[model samples]
Target chain A: MLRLCSENIHSFFASESPDEHEPPMPRSLTSANMTGRAPGHTTGKERILTSAMLLFARTPYSDTSLRDIATAAGVDVAYVHRAFGSKAEIFRQALLTLGPLDDIAAGEPDGATMISRICDLAFLRNPNRVEDVRPLHLLIQSSLCGEARAIIAQFIDSSLALPLSRAFGHADAGKAHFALSLLSGFVTHRAVLGPADLLAIPEAVQQRMLQTALMNAMLDRSDPGIQGQIN
Target chain B: MLRLCSENIHSFFASESPDEHEPPMPRSLTSANMTGRAPGHTTGKERILTSAMLLFARTPYSDTSLRDIATAAGVDVAYVHRAFGSKAEIFRQALLTLGPLDDIAAGEPDGATMISRICDLAFLRNPNRVEDVRPLHLLIQSSLCGEARAIIAQFIDSSLALPLSRAFGHADAGKAHFALSLLSGFVTHRAVLGPADLLAIPEAVQQRMLQTALMNAMLDRSDPGIQGQIN
Candidate 1:
């Protein structure tokens, strides 16, 4: 409860940083290099977030812990609590470094561009971009716990939903909100759930379906019968 | 691990029951009414599941304990442990009483019937059917924990997904799987997450939008422009 109030209080002063409005830099440069410390050094919080991003990617939220984050970050566990409050708070901070929300579907005029941006986050098996997708991976992995879902919901509400809503340029935020919600569902369904036949589709065709389905979600006002549109 | 294998072994002997193929009854008739043991005299396991279903609906998985379930069901905690193995296993058992997979979006020839089946599950606040939606509520509530998600995924694969796939009568199960995936995402998005403006849209209009968008997910082959086709 204190954590929730404190965060609200801080954000009141933290004017939406100009950095957020700027297109996100390549993640590698953004995370460690731009800590504004000595180039080789990271703030203890940054290191903890970096370690957390990794450990969370590898395990479920239940299995990952402050001790694990501290061990990975080479910091004291007490310091992690003092600074971050709880695992969920650390997760929120980590979500901040996960590039721009616009990188996923916001600000894209077309489906092809949208897919290109997010392929790194959830769909593709790009080893180099694995870090970019860990937040999503962790979301899917931790989706079964109430607290984790609450934190994620809070993050989406306060952070992800509005930017995408604004980026969609709709007076009504419903389109972007529903679209992203649908996207998360598609990812969860395909990644962890069954009906193995979906995996059997040629990856290329599935990508087309994903693009088309999402576009439909955004513009749900479409006539229902006209089918077979691909970006 | 032992629980998993035991389940698999039992399912192998348990030929698909005729009860599965029959259309599901209303929620009131399905859960306690058809326990097959007796009308008012539910078995200890049934009572335990009954309590679990209610308790899990109210709290997250981590917060809902074996002791809580025992107290609610009027049984000893040891019985819950001995019978259910763990909280997750009990959850799995409770998921079974959640009517049928077809109750969501399956076997129906059109979108109108599809909506009716599931309006009871997650979309409506139909108080009489609150018990029916408990499985989805629990799935959403516990979605933040890895163990909980794993079990849900397992349950989805083993029980829910294929039935819907078969019901859709598609040689390709991708459509059904993807549709259900999209549905869960929508529910999670609108319910737990935000873009609160959506709630402002009259509920009746929201229902129509849901039906249209879900149909689109199942039929992603549509020309992107043919929009606004409501079921």
Candidate 2:
């Protein structure tokens, strides 16, 4: 059973053809180059984030320690501390590296457009950009437990709320927040609860349905009446 | 600062009169003298679940321990063990008590209705069913790690997929999995992620937008040729 499961997982990954849809990773940021500190001040920070992201993708946050992250990044513990004030800060920064909300905000034309763009950005960045999507899942699972909840809650609030409200004309902060909540929920669900076919359903179908639902939500929000009612 | 925050939290909880839309607990099953348990079966299991739910709601899963739950439930460790085989099992069963998906499934008219009903049910349950809503945020926060990821992933797969697929009538199991992922994401996001002001975008607005989007998606599935072609 284990062998079969392994073979199936291998086939699934093989079928995905990483090159086709995988987001580009900066050469400097790749796991392979994340080690051996450079003379630049922020290089160590970047390396730490890269290593942390990779490890985070594979392990739960509780299981991951600053020392472990430092080892993975080939940096000293002191260097890790200098770069990020704490584990929470490092994890937050690492998540930001996946794709910053600021970039999504900058691309939108209006509140409605912003919502669509944000959803698209989240979907695109999530499955593809993060090396393994698994660590993101682990982080969320950990949030269900301790001090991590506050950090996770704050990260989500800022990532989705601040920029989303800005795009929604500030007056419609409520609407923007609601929209953000919906979008994040969708993205997190996919990130954590997916690879659905092994236990539930196939992957392609799930993607299509999600894209459809998201597009629908976007189009509905575009209507002036709908936006007015929400505001 | 902590005291201030606690005071504010207390004020918020105290001021908010219980809304009519609270979720129905399996009170009929777990009430003090319910018929569900075998005679002489100590109500320790139910108490453990109650404590677990409360702690899991306030604290992240990792930070919460079996001992904490035992202490809160006012039961011996041995009682907890007799009731739940493990902490994960306790968490899982506690969440299940919030509402069974099967209960929702039994009430739907068809696949489309199933989605609508589930959404409505989740919305209604979210405010009332603190147990269900609490774990959602925690789970999302923890998804960044490993063992937690596995546990949550399995729960999503087992608990959400099959029932959602049956409701959707998608011939392909993969499609069903995707549908559930999308739904779960939407619900969780709505339940947690943002401030009440942001979330309070008027129920009418939410309903209209969600219904329109849902209908559009359904139509697209019913007639693939018109997919993306329609506004």
Candidate 3:
């Protein structure tokens, strides 16, 4: 895929100011953005990105075109084309900005810790990501273009699957890929289908089953069921 | 939730001729359409529908306009609006046309049978249905319009979840809904992510784990793991 190569790619996904209503400070560090900045402060590119991410989050990619993003950002379409390169590039940035996976990756890289953290997040809320700017929903709603698929696949393979496989020494890549895919499916199901009532089983049991499934898949444990089977 | 209410709703989903390329015959029974027909023959509405279904299958719903369908169907835009009522309605019709779930429901409707049939279909092919017309892909690609969501949720509730709950007498509806949601996730993951190399574990063990996850979810079995635990 041709690179979009935003001139400020390094700062393109910097943390937003606590003001929350303003466009994110694309050029500044998080500590600088968070402290003593007025709520109205922003740059043109930050404005464009905020509008683009919000619009992309709210509507399917097919529904929100370059023109729409520009209109929402108060810029013209040509500027958007020049700056973001393509809608797919804009989406890739939004996903990086919104996802928690980076946080997990930046923390402990243990296989069980990774699986348990994801499971904890999965059931902790009801219809959680559907109403928000979530990476899972963003990826789900985006059109399956080569650029976008390649971007997501590369991210998952590098971020989640690779770390997971390394955590289980000498584990072939296939099991890690399958484990992440199943976990993705589990999350996608909730994000796309919205919420259903809680299952008849105790919530703890449900979480254990999910955690066990992922661990068993990820670690290739010989245990017939859960890698950490409930006693 | 106004329906486009095509008068031939029953026949709208009738099985197509194995001839494979022509518009399905709307007026005749499937046996007749399969037995004998000139390769090019089709009804005006059938031609319109065939065009609409193919376009919807190929492109995300937001990108494919009613005018686009009209052009492909060789009809005026007004005629499409007159016939299908709206883009969402057209997609609803298209989903019903492509789905295999109706076939399962039309068969014995056994609980494990329903779950296994879907699982088998999920893994039996590689990157299956991403390149072709499929109900799951259509739903995923379609914008999350209220009418489309309602149509799908209603169908799942009536066809799969309800019957599944019934299979295990005294079961709560919550368990069945959760079970189907997870299964939907499993299928959705495969459809959207394309494919990966098979898991390092034996295929049989993977299937057993998946089956156990779903059966345990659906039946609310008290056993710690796989309702039918592997020996």
TM-score of chain A of each: 0.72, 0.60, 0.65
Report candidate 1's interface RMSD in Å.
10.7
List model 3 lDDT by residue over A97-202, tens digit each: 5543554554555666666655654542211222233344455444233435656666666656677777666446666766666666555444444435433456
Q: Which 10-residue window of candidate 3 chain A scores lowest in summed lDDT?
A: A1-10
User: Per-residue lDDT of B2-94 in model 1, one digit per residue for the tens?
Assistant: 000001111211233434333233455343434565467778888887788776654556667899999999999999999989987888777
Q: Give per-residue CA lDDT, model 3, range B9-96, as digits (tens).
A: 1121222232443221122322222225565676656667667766654455555788998899899999989988988787776655
Q: Could you tell me the lDDT of residue A111 within candidate 2?
A: 49
Q: How do the residues B185-214 of candidate 2 rate in per-residue lDDT, one tens digit apiece?
A: 545555433366545767656655554444
Question: How high is the TM-score of chain B in model 2?
Answer: 0.66
lDDT of 3 at A136: 44
Query: What is the Å distance of residue B35 in model 2 from its true position?
Result: 2.9
Go through the candidates in order and give the clash count of each. Answer: 25, 46, 0
At residue B32, candidate 1 shows an lDDT of 42
Ranking by lDDT: 1, 3, 2
Clash pairs of candidate 3? none
What's the C-alpha lDDT at position A160 in model 3? Answer: 62
TM-score ranking, best first? 1, 2, 3
